[model samples]
Target: MDLPRDAQHDAVIVGGGHNGLVAAAYLARAGRSVLLLERLPATGGAAVSTRAFTGVDARLSRYSYLVSLLPRKIVDDLGLRFAVRRRGISSYTPHRDTGLLVDARDTARTREQFARLTGSERDFEAWQRFYAMTAHVARRVFPTLTEPLPTRAELERKVADPAAWEALFERPLGETVEAAFADDTVRGVVLTDALIGTFTHAHDPSLRQNRCFLYHVIGGGTGDWDVPIGGMGAFTDALADAARSAGARIVTGAEVTSIATDGRVAEVAYEDAATGRTHTVAARDVLVNASPHALAGLLGAPRPPRPEGAQLKVNMLLRRLPRLRDRAVDPADAFAGTFHVAEGYRQLQTAYEQAAAGRVPDAPPSEIYCHSLTDPSILSPELAATGAHTLTLFGLHAPARLFAADPEGTKRELLAATLAQLDAVLDEPLADCLATDADGRPCLEAKSPLDLEREVGLPGGHIFHRDLSWPYAQAPDAADAADEAGGPGTDVTQATGRWGVGTGCGNVFLCGAGAVRGGGVSGVPGHNAARAVLEKAR
Candidate 1:
């Protein structure tokens, strides 16, 4: 079948992932003729679920891995029905003699428990003050993620206000934690939030930004942490359904081969892989959900420059539940929320160093989640009866640029080593219940973070479109400071400003993790992109 070529729409969104779908939905809702094209047969990109095991459907990125910094108002405004269940995230660190679990719900009780276990009242108090301060800053600044970058006047105001500036952008998370806690265990627990889904070390100055990053997960006022009821895919499915209902046309298995520009605007050339047919669609605008590097390749151009970090991912399927040493934990607790295997702050720093050197750590710092423990509906009847589960292990970082050297073999070894590490940690004999060969690891898939640079067409797979550094956010003279700081390159503020959905680059705008607020599954970039387009149409 030859691909159908419709008349030019108001926008042609490439990559029908969550963000693309979101941008399309907003455009369609605003009465624009919008079309969404995806290379894969299904939408959602990373935020998807697939039937991997026989009779089992599991989220691709399990647990939506704790909500990204998406805005709540957009959810209500779009009438999106991706049901998110709220629960406080818990962190646990177990040693030979002691273990500690930090619960966001009963902070007072949790604090008491911490104080008892670590014998550090000062640490507990510090944690309280830090959380309160960080949460306050997050409340004020995170909302700006959905809007365009701050104007010069607003930026100046924030920079001039000492209290406002420190609360929002200046306080270093590590320094803050060190000042608050004398116990290593308590300090480790507080720092875990900074490392979740990221490769940053606990001691790095960049970790301060992570403090604000945690606030994004708190859901504005919806409380901290939410699990989409049916799994993360439901969130994407709801957005897709909402987009279609709102009159956006979505075509999957339609790989965008190139974005050819006629010097004035861009037209996307795509190949429908299933039919071996090619087609072209003209648009005044385009939104790419792929990583910046991937997008640059499709455009047949030198990728725009990027920052120096990479994004990598790993997924796992387990035949049995993780046997944790913390006997007090309810068996149900394993699946109810995320589990952090952070031994201490130094341990995390070592892992980051190893990754930087292009080596996997022997005892990796990991954040593990067992979806079967949380959502039983996806498990097979037999698996559920036997308490089998699917576990996702994130936080294995390597030089982002290393994937090109030995992608498959390296990933295979990393996955095998990770499982071995898991075996070492578990009290039970996990090796006995192995369902798949060690050589053919199913869940452990790897992708270079630098690849995001290509896919999203951003500078260094440094998504978030720009780096939300303190200097960028708090500079009194944003335009002048950004200009001086960047010299001739794009910095954070300019990146955030260009993220308006339909307003930037002659209809080509941005949405997704690489936009203004960067990566995570929050859907904020998508939502913001949509609003930008809709506002323009109005």
Candidate 2:
């Protein structure tokens, strides 16, 4: 089914995610006829911050929380009003009597903390060297993510540090971490960043962990993962406002079912989610911000390898901060930033091995950070005065296949194990300090990969859409441009590697996480797709 030719839009975007909204705003600002459709009753996709508890006033970043990779250029170019606040304390990993606290701004304190944790000043110096290397790589590679993919050799040459490249870009992250840091605890602290949402082992031969580590460290070149000022909702809402102000039309609950590009004007057919009525629209180009698997399924093509999400997310609002057993550290400081729990290198390896065999890790490695601790804007005045705060825990190594056998049972078991692990490090039982909403229920909910897939449109619940790819393209001998890597889209005049946003169909472009350089809430895919469109029109 095709809409009337007269109704053709200059561009149509499917999926009203942050990426799609960004595309709409840019295209509309550029004076193109733009329209965006979202299946949900509202936009924002997984980037939204909502009050998940039935009666809590705390607005938590439900799924995709934190701002690490969002390019400042996108925010400045779009004139987005969203503000991201940097955390003072970077991270804390508590073990027996003491903990490893990383202070972002206080270098002297950070050194002192490391010296005590490692019981030697040598590890602290090594820590400085490792971060210096990452800082250098972050500076060089962050800018290139938004640009056209450079050849691997080109990027390596630009990075220039062979040791940095080998540790981050080439070798398994585990081997690199082991070689750089001598202390076991320090090694774990450094390695945690490499395995955030990724489910691979540190020594996985696939180098999947290396790609994941690059993205986490290369945040807008500064490598600072800032917290959104008001919740994630405020940030996405600003994007929506910018799009509307630029004259782009956005329709919620308009589920796009099919996209066909066989004819002159590409056709987008959708059923009104609100009214269950079918309709077709015409577009000169369609920017799909949905998952790649979703796009393939929509096009009736053979699906890509099923993407598997490998983390369990639990969002909880606590009445007060949990007590820490470590007397040297204050509870406030410990929870203020990323609080790493059970994330040691050996612990992570054991969990991965367990989960890989189709069993949920007995003691899951996870990290928790209190968003309200950093930005009180997430809570109302009453809630804040009452000492209520929001805690979001991300449990690692809980892969999709583990939940595939028994999703409900597995989620409960995993959440139980995850929290128990957290409780072990705390001075008191975690549940004892939990908050209750107006409904008299605990202000906590856990989402497994299956839950994310069902609710947030993440295919197979994979957050990065799938395993992340390197920022640069392979050499000529490596790129399979003709077929598997990337094919001609129905309307795309020029087809390039998978790194290019161009779909095999000429008129369709993937502006989702599946697009290379697209991970987290970074708007690189949207920005790149728009630039590609504008370039082609010229």
Candidate 3:
């Protein structure tokens, strides 16, 4: 897949991860000559699968693991062949002997469970109200993520209608959830989503941003959280296939050294990994899917500092499924879906405060997922027979600077601390179920925030391309700041923002979680970025 030096392309996409690949597919489909480059030996970035162990095949970043918000339009328009298996998520609090299950397409049953847990007639009623309101907001706002940011006047018109603004963004999600439920259990269950994949504390004022997070889970129309048939990576592979099928050239193992811009357009100067040859590709535009921190450094600039509350990610691989004490539930059902391990709001708050201080929380909040339950194909036959599972522990915030001192040692201590917290809830023998790679040492410590930061080139290893806070919101004004700061192009209002895929700098776009939509497995960024590029061309 080698193109000669001086080969000119309509667009050059840096990074062959899922979002970049998706962008490439859409642009190539539109008759644009697009070139995608990847520094890794293979593409997919975090949405990748590797044989970390001899007999085990699992996805990297497994727990940030599910994909439900991928726009239905992308699936149909791209003729994507991947199948998404629907297995709902569940939450368990071992100490209280309480749990909640989110089933597929049964809002009534879910409400009933809420009523039972809360023992109040208002529980079900509030649940319905909250769902309806959030669903409405998601419908209005989620579309904008794929579309380019609206004009200020247009935005004023959209939000100028008092009812529309209240329904979409003005109302606080945290306060709404709190008012909706009488029992702590029901509130806890709903509020857990606020902190799910993010580093935000559950009680933090910023948690309101997650108001629509759960609503987008409805998949724009499909009603459940869906995982690709083979595994998460299947979606990535399908995207790559789609890009290639559309005549886009993807070169993995090629790292761009610098962007040689002639003050008007950008050219990519890169080193080919296989041949160690230096090559340059001139293009009308360059799309970068690397993290903002990484992109800044690549431009020979100092790393942009992360905001005060930005969090770190710690991913792990476990050998066996977690054991919970609820005898009413079958042991097999435990692995059937995702689980939130935090006990309550107070605990969640404490953990967040600790992480903010650069110390691992004494009881860190974790959202655990066992992918083997939904996608058994991800596991080897031997591992499957033994009831082995691939577990992902997310939302553990460790400081990036601390790791800069002693990467390996600090990472090990962080893992040990997280395991100690897990020991408080699960009954499984931690030692017996711990995963070991081919080396026979614990595999849990392999992927840390530092590794992600180093690999993706984001400053502070901040997974969300831009912090999803006030100044970083994905609006038109936000795009200006991104431009000034050289932030990743994430203008959610723009159609081309998906992968930032296109021809000129402004002509090219970005989407996926890294774009304005921030972070998530949802393909909204890619879908939206594509539409922007195509619409502008037209």
Candidate 4:
């Protein structure tokens, strides 16, 4: 059906990020008229690629750099022509003069390396057993992401392993890691997943780290973060294509200011950035693909506490891979996978303590990877042939609050400190390996939490939008659902039912990171929201 200019759409999706595009495509394919409005001149949000430095030929996955949480079901359902290349090595963490290298392709080598680092095979044996448990949980739980919300009891039964569930879900991740690993570096490597973008201690009673760890380990039922071939934009670009082909109208530079709903129908008011003219469109349902804070502002509801992000994102075009202090490892092999820096278990706890005290860590912990090593397609032929590479570093314990007073100054100070940590494990200074732009400036750029908020509209630069949620339904006897609504994106009401994406108003649903099981680059929330609309219609 050709929708008239003034026709009420079946769905009006605010924020044409990946999730919005996914929802629009699904709905439109189901013969529902869909209109997607985006504030930015472009879509993709954080999952986008761009040349950070002027005259640079390499396109970097500037923000969210890997493809882990994105489901293959979404890719196949949408027929997105995208691919991810796995690195041969999983990770490498350098200790004094030596390091621990986990090889994805060769477990025997990884075991040997572990034994060499820790002076015994006990930690390696424990590592294998611990991840085996997570793998079992991942296999059981990952499939539930695209399905309707399952009750906690139902999910628990599905997991089957009591030990795995208790270690991952009940106990603090710190206790679990401490019990499982003897080496500080190995323990830190395992715990890094729990603290990425989350500003929390390992032993925090809140179990926020546990939630973060679950999402990281459960992606695609394997938890391997593969490099998106042709950069991160490839996924969203394909999503946009699929949405348009399915007859969804995508309006870029349209700022959706407010959503007015009365349970049954909704009016979306947006201002076109180009014309500076306001337009209100009626829709049977609305899908929000923005942060919880943005959603509250749109619905004219009380804003929740701002979620603080805790990482400094740095993107760089390197002339060549930096040499490592450990001569046993090749730079190519080291950069091919995640290179751990200043992230020993004790170091991580100390950094968290310092950051919590409103100071940058003396030595910032970080995970660095050279995406070009696995997928050189992100670089131009010239750059790729010249051995030029892309380095993406995610610095931890640098919370948004640390940069609130002076974002620029703190960003510079933090970058200096973070790079200093990286250099400690390297043979030479990282600055010397940076490629120069046309204007002769180093091709390195760092984004503090404030920068993410300003540029990507991420509230407080919380990349997962807010704290990640458990992927199950609350118990029937649980406290008022509205009170238990962990994020502003979720607002339970009498009309809301099994779907976790539902809002207080019946006609609105969240299809963004704030939605349950909706963080990362995964389009699960969008898929679930569309499914909810379909189920309601049925």
Best by TM-score: 4
Q: Residue pairs in steric clash, candidate 4? A: none
Residue 346 in candidate 1, Cα distance off native in Å: 0.6
TM-score, every prediction:
0.82, 0.96, 0.83, 0.96
Please report, in order, the local distance difference test score of every candidate based on alpha carbons. 0.59, 0.84, 0.60, 0.88
Which of candidates 2 and 4 reaches a greater lDDT? Answer: 4
- Candidate 3 — what's its lDDT? 0.60
**Candidate 2 lDDT over residue span 298-364, tens digit each:** 7666667778888999999999998898888998999888898888778888899999998988789
Model 1, runs deviating above 4 Å: 1-6, 55-64, 152-164, 202-218, 221-223, 262-265, 298-301, 306-314, 317-320, 380-382, 401-404, 433-504
lDDT of 4: 0.88
lDDT of candidate 1 over 1-538, digit per residue (tens): 3434545777788877677877778778888888899877788776677654443444445323456465776678679986666555465566543456666678786777676677766766766776666565556556666666665457446435555455334566666667667776667666666654445665556653454355443455332666556677777889899899999888888888887654235788889888788888887667777655555566565565655443344555666665566565553554455565644667666767877787766656656666655466665566568656666666444545555577667656665665565555566755565445234544434444555444434344343443433212333344333322332233322333333332123344556555545566667667766665565455
Comparing 2 with 3 on TM-score, the higher-scoring candidate is 2
Rank by TM-score (best first) = 4, 2, 3, 1
Report the backbone clash tally of model 1.
27
Worst 10 residues of 4 by lDDT: 486-495
Say what the RMSD of model 4 is.
Answer: 2.7
